[model samples]
Target: MLLSKASLEAACGRKTIRAAVPSLVSPFQLTVRSLPKQQTERRLVPMRRSKAVSVQNNFSILALDDDPIMISTLQAYFQRSGYHVDIENDPYRAIERIRKTHYDILLLDFLMTPICGDQVVEEIRKFNKELFIILLTGHKSMAPPIRTIRELDIQGYYEKSDRFDQLELLVESCAKSIRQMRTIHSYQNGLSAIVDALPAVYQLQSLEQLGGTLLETAAGLLHASSGYLFLKQSDETPAMHPQKDPELFCTFECTITKEQARAQYTATVFPDQKTIVQQNKMSAPLFDTRHSMIGMLHLVLPHAPQYEQVQLLDIFSRQAVVAVHNIQLHGLVRSKNNELTQVLGKLRDSYVDIVSVVRLMVDARDIYTRGHSDRVSKFSRRIAETMKLDRETCERVSLGGLFHDIGKIGVPDYILLKPDKLTFEEYNVIKRHPDEGADILAATSFFRDIVEIVRQHHERVDGKGYPRGLTGDKIFVEAKIITVADCFDAMVSDRQYRKGLGVSAAVHQLQQGRGTQFMPEAVDAFLSLLDKEHGKEVLSLYDTLPSTI
Candidate 1:
């Protein structure tokens, strides 16, 4: 189980691990620990102790700085790595401490009080000759720190103004130096994690968490105070996140961020003590599919130095390239996945709509014809199988049967759902369904093939049919198949106001009209299959059959 900050702090008897730490390592350094079972007061009051926390450990650090925020940030970053962090805020106090105590690492702030920064470092080396001294400066000045390094044997130095990503690298480098471990690229894993969680567009809370998580992990490797991430929008609005703006989706919530801490960093911003804080846009990205190097991540330092440029930002730039590639890949996958999901949903809806509309039309007719299209569609598909039509063709034929009477949408309602037969006017109106359906369908682009089947279902094999008296050879083969199935189902169905025509009579009617109404070849094919086991199975599926009586 992970310990809460309150519990850990209470157990340690300190507000933070740094102040509680002692210079020398021992169990006596346990300023606080497993608490009393029951205290007179649950709240532990803060105490100023003479001893340091984690002094019994192998390493000791003397972090010297005037800015408490900067000291706190570094202390916390190192504390998580299981190292002792001791702060020396006053420059006078820092030099005195270095003279008296034994320290493994010396962290000195470049800008401080009471004495000059370089003077403190010079004095510290005077007493503790072998300390692994590191200058934690708050500026981008090369001359002061570099001159010292060139002159003396300074173990390591970190720029406070470096992006947290850089700080993390420095920390890792320092840790690895002391521990004698190999250095690894901090970016490979960060880029991979971000890539895995992509398409860049995520829910607000999730995105914020991702930002912090990636930066923190990256910082752990870079040894920086924090990291920052920003994306450029395709378009911009002046009043950003104006009113509950969804555009302000990305955020900064990490304790480790590019927020201004009280640390004096050696920034390469200005020659004097003046700090420059320019907010540059992360737009016009250089990232793309084949090669990705996006907009710059300005590693803004509080003060300017003569020798800071592309080399200083190189590590971040390389990592940024990976981030761009992973993010773009995520975007592509998400877009395609969303598109496919939508398409599949539409196809499903079309299937439902087709079945419903056809059923509605059939219901508009008599009860006996209620399941006509449904059953015939099923049987026509089975017939298509024996005809050896490909699966796609078979499926289309089945769908066409369901919509064969779509032209009936144009048929007068009185004549369509009517229980009685047609008068002269009703017959003419009924005959118009094929043309009406064809016209209705011609308006849409994709349904032209379906429209052909609808237009010809009424046309008979003989020259006596209504719509286009186009006899045998004039009809399409698939339409000829539907015409046969249409007659088979219609004859077998009992009219609303008539006794049902038994299955035998229905089949006998078709056999008699073999060459007259249906294509003889089509009728022969359907009957041959109907005489077999599967045909009987198809017939048995319905309560009544169109038997050739």
Candidate 2:
């Protein structure tokens, strides 16, 4: 049976145990009955309230008992002690109240009608294992089994008595325990967030970008107001630290040894921040698996870091090493790729210049052909542009035109500069120049794409031209443009023994040859190009060329 202070005094009249002042050695102490049956060692919990108790005053407590008197007593006492307290007289209703509200501690009466205190704790533990529990019972015999107390994680047992000092001490202890748990949980969450972001952070390819993100994440997770990252050239050599940026309020450049990197301790103040207020600092060395310490991440927090925070920063340092290695690898690959591109570009330019020089040298042998390849290159480019070819294709056509007659360099001077009509043997010898030009360029991989164009430039649509004359659609489109450009320039320009035919006559010759000697599409584009602004410039430039006598 439960009895309150007033009701017990009225029933027993100063003779009841509920109203008597308890005889004790201290304000709160465990009786010998608190000893567990399984162990001889008694668990001791010191409960002398500190002169300066720093526990959270707003902490909440839920007190449950079938006696409304007992519940009211606990609510009044804890409420006066600066805690938020809720009271419930039914065990089932207590479980429901706990489900709806969050409490730091639970005070439960051990003996109740319908449901005992152990059963109430069992139900609450199912949903709220974190709430600290203390049992209050009138009879030691009515207390739950020792196993039940341990299994339900009950923190204290207060035999019901007139004095509430023991229960108050238990509540204070629970508050301190809850505070410590929340502090540790906060550090765990910060570490989890940093771990989850590693995939994206390491994916950054640029050194500057990766460094900035890594330092920012590290400092932010540690609640630092300012920090700096220092990069080393190598593990043994001095680091090439950056000049202090205006952004960092604190910068630390002291080198950390391998032993220091492994230490999970945070200093109260780093050497660099000695002039400023003493604040917490975490330093981590970024080193690869090769044991090369390449950089360090230093963060300056406003206060001392917890043990968990220091340990988490150490883990971050190990991950940062791997991230820095990947950034360096990406940088190396990017540098090599750019170098290869520049070298290939220069080689291609020099190769084209060599082709032009060869054509000019060959043309120099005959006065009438000095600038013949140059004019052919300009006209071919105009035709390609009129056809709306891509820039690379247009440039390829121009290059093919410049080298189209390069094979003439192999012809004897007597046959090349005859200055008269050639016999069949001499004409046959001249017809081999296209094949010769292709063979000369075939040895270089750089000119592989243009070889077929150079070989087929002289072939005709009707298959009557030289060097594998079987043609039509078989001829490269670029080869067809070169053929039209070559013939058009030859007609309008001076030859060794004939006068220059004007643009109109040259265009008429192209119209007559369309679909038989030249590609119809190529001929149409070339004629259309002659009407445009650039084409008019080509026409006027050719008019200045020295004409036949």
Candidate 3:
């Protein structure tokens, strides 16, 4: 027979016993005699007060049983032991409640009407495998099979009895195990977060981006509510100098107000201060490879971090220091690159000035050819533009035209300035000017793009031209455009040898040479440019030049 609630309370004092009333039994009969002497003595021994407090704060338990008496007894007994206990008589409702709320341990009855204890365990196990479960049975024989217990991962089994000493002992054991497991899991998660944060920290190129990511990652690792990063910078002093004060680079906050974060920031001394782990607050110095402090990270955590959490924080701080160093190096490299680019631009302008002087010297040797290269340059650029060529190709063609006859500087004055038509030998000497021009310009990297254009401008589309007779597609498109421009300008401009051919005559010559002596595309593009207002203005420049030397 089961003892009445009044009798059970009187016998156990403040500690309640988890016992069940058998069906068809008289509730009035006291069953205190059924408890063994060993069990009775064990119940008299006091449990550790600190352990009970820890359990009450850190763990919660849910008691699920069909019998109201069984549920009430289990709740009273566990609650008296300083555990957060919730009781439910309906198994379905208990499963639903467990789904919504996280309970650390489950005190489940073995026998129920619709679903057995193993069935309930199966349902719970499908979604939650981490819950620590202890099954309570009316008798040893009524307990679930060992296979069912092992398969379902049920932690322990307790048979219902007059005394609750054994059940209490089992729960205490499980609680200790749970606390250890929780610690291990927390450490695992912290380590995983550190690993995940490393790549992002290292890959960021700018200080602002690195700072933001570092602060966020550090805050997340410690579960901090707010944080700020202070990066070291000095305008007149080295960053690692002992006298330099750290600068506040950036700040990040979550669930903390800016004013409060600012006040905390103001209160803390940086760079010189070592790592601090105080109640709800932590700050660590970031150091580079040289062991010099580069920055400081301060965080406002939710609680005092444990020793392991502080260790994790240290690991993360070391990694963040490397990230800070890398970003600083990247900034330095970018600054140097920009400086180099400016220097290169000045040098390039100097080279162009030198080339202009050389072109002037070439023109001075023959009065009739004065401004001849300039006209060809403008004409080539216009033709290139009309052909829908890219800007870079157009610029190359224009420069190539200006320098195409540069090798005339190498030609003998008597042969170059001759008033009559050149003999075959002199004509061959003129063809060599293209190769000589290419050789002269090839000495500078700046003019490399136009070297081929200068060399191949005289190449015929039919593979019948000089200085490496490259045909049609083999010749550079830029050179082909320059060929057409050079031919038109040479024919239309007056020379020491002959009067200038009119624009109509030059066009007729270009039409006659198309596809055989010149690229058809280049001829068509040049003719098209001649129809435009800009091209007509260019043509007018040649009209003002001397008709004869």
Candidate 4:
């Protein structure tokens, strides 16, 4: 049904209106000189105002109406209401405004010139996809047809019968909307600033420097009194041996200890700023590079009242952990590159360099057993010396122990440290150690003897062992000697799961397993050597282990 002018005005009640720009434009200043009133003087008069207002820099409202009085009234209303409202008596000018500057809200005259309000609305939409438009007309019939509003996503339609009252409310309502939008914008800006400043400070290399960054930036953003960052390093020196570095920390906990953190660092690293002012949870924020689980960061207030916001502190703590992890990954790449570069350099050395390099690797694997391969090699030489083996044979025996379990490099840390029983699959994996050891030895020159020893280390007297199990004399004497030493070490050294038996108990177990698990002669020789040197005195040699460690 066709609608009349009064019907449209009747439908236009007092509903709220608001202005929101999808994008904001920054404003620049233009100082203009005032021009003189008389042409005779041709003097300049001070320009009182520019086309746009300072506060309205980010927003612009375009108003179009054919009636000069009505258009002038609406313009005056918006200008006083803090809007940079552009006026267009010609509906075509409204179309031009959209093409030129960005406008947030469009106020169009339903009774405008050359183009009617409805036609103007349609054209404005084509060029200004985001401009929100409202229709204004004195004749209620001039208001948009219901079909247009429902389909066009238009803001609203206003009737002009009560021009002064309706236009004032329309202008004020859009202003309130702009104010609320500004509120949300300010909040978003603050949030972005805080997050952006974080990575800048967290990248500090030294703990003290990182701590300072955490404290300063955190206090500035979170309104924290002070805070600290904590971090930890993961040890990767093979699973048979475990090592840990002192955890790094960034905290505000006035008094905190490593023992205390070890007990409770997993819980809330960010204490509620609300509760922090109320009680201490003994927790702190933790983070590090390498993408590793760095320790926590703690934000502390000397007095709880000193901090009004701890939630921000918590957010920072969580972000720091994520940052630390990335740093650790970067460090790992660098370390691996260095290791590969070193390996490439070593590739140029001689055949004897292979044996020298293997000895160096064993010594370098862990501080606790830095000289272990060397010591075991010496022992193998003495035993061979006693047997009056050939010079080359004796040398092979000594070097064999040096590379005996070198295949261990293939074992993953978790599996190597398995503290409990293994499935058949896991045991099968463990069985590959001998072959792996052999492969490592065979990779370089002058290692054929050592390779043979590694490959045959698990082969037994009864032909029940792996990788071509050889019975009796089929296994090399040197290989048999390594089997004895390997078993002795396994039996006497503590593992991830179990404590080793003392030397005497281990010797007894060997005696029992002889001919079944070991050769009887090797067992006899092992026991005779321990009998000469007190087993108790050998255990005492490790007393130099760091007393404070």
Clashing pairs in 2: none
**76-124: candidate 1 lDDT, tens digit per residue:** 5555555777887888887777778876677776555567567876776
lDDT values, one for every candidate? 0.54, 0.72, 0.76, 0.59
Arrange candidates by lDDT, descending: 3, 2, 4, 1
Measured on C-alpha atoms, candidate 2 has an lDDT of 0.72
**Candidate 1 regions off by >4 Å?**
1-294, 297-358, 417-421, 435-449, 461-474, 496-517, 532-535, 541-549
| TM-score, structure 1 vs. true | 0.38
Q: Name the top TM-score candidate.
A: 3
Model 2 regions lying over 4 Å from their true place: 1-63, 67-101, 104-188, 196-212, 225-279, 285-297, 300-303, 321-349, 364-370, 385-396, 407-477, 489-509, 525-549
lDDT at 464, model 1: 80
Clashes in model 3: which pairs? none
Question: How much is the lDDT of residue 134 in candidate 2?
Answer: 83
lDDT, candidate 4, 415-523, per-residue tens:
6657788778888887898898787667665576578787888787889988787888888988877677767666665554666676678878888888877877766
What's the distance in Å from true for residue 270, model 1? 14
The TM-scores, one per candidate, come to 0.38, 0.59, 0.73, 0.38
When 2 and 3 are scored with lDDT, the better candidate is: 3
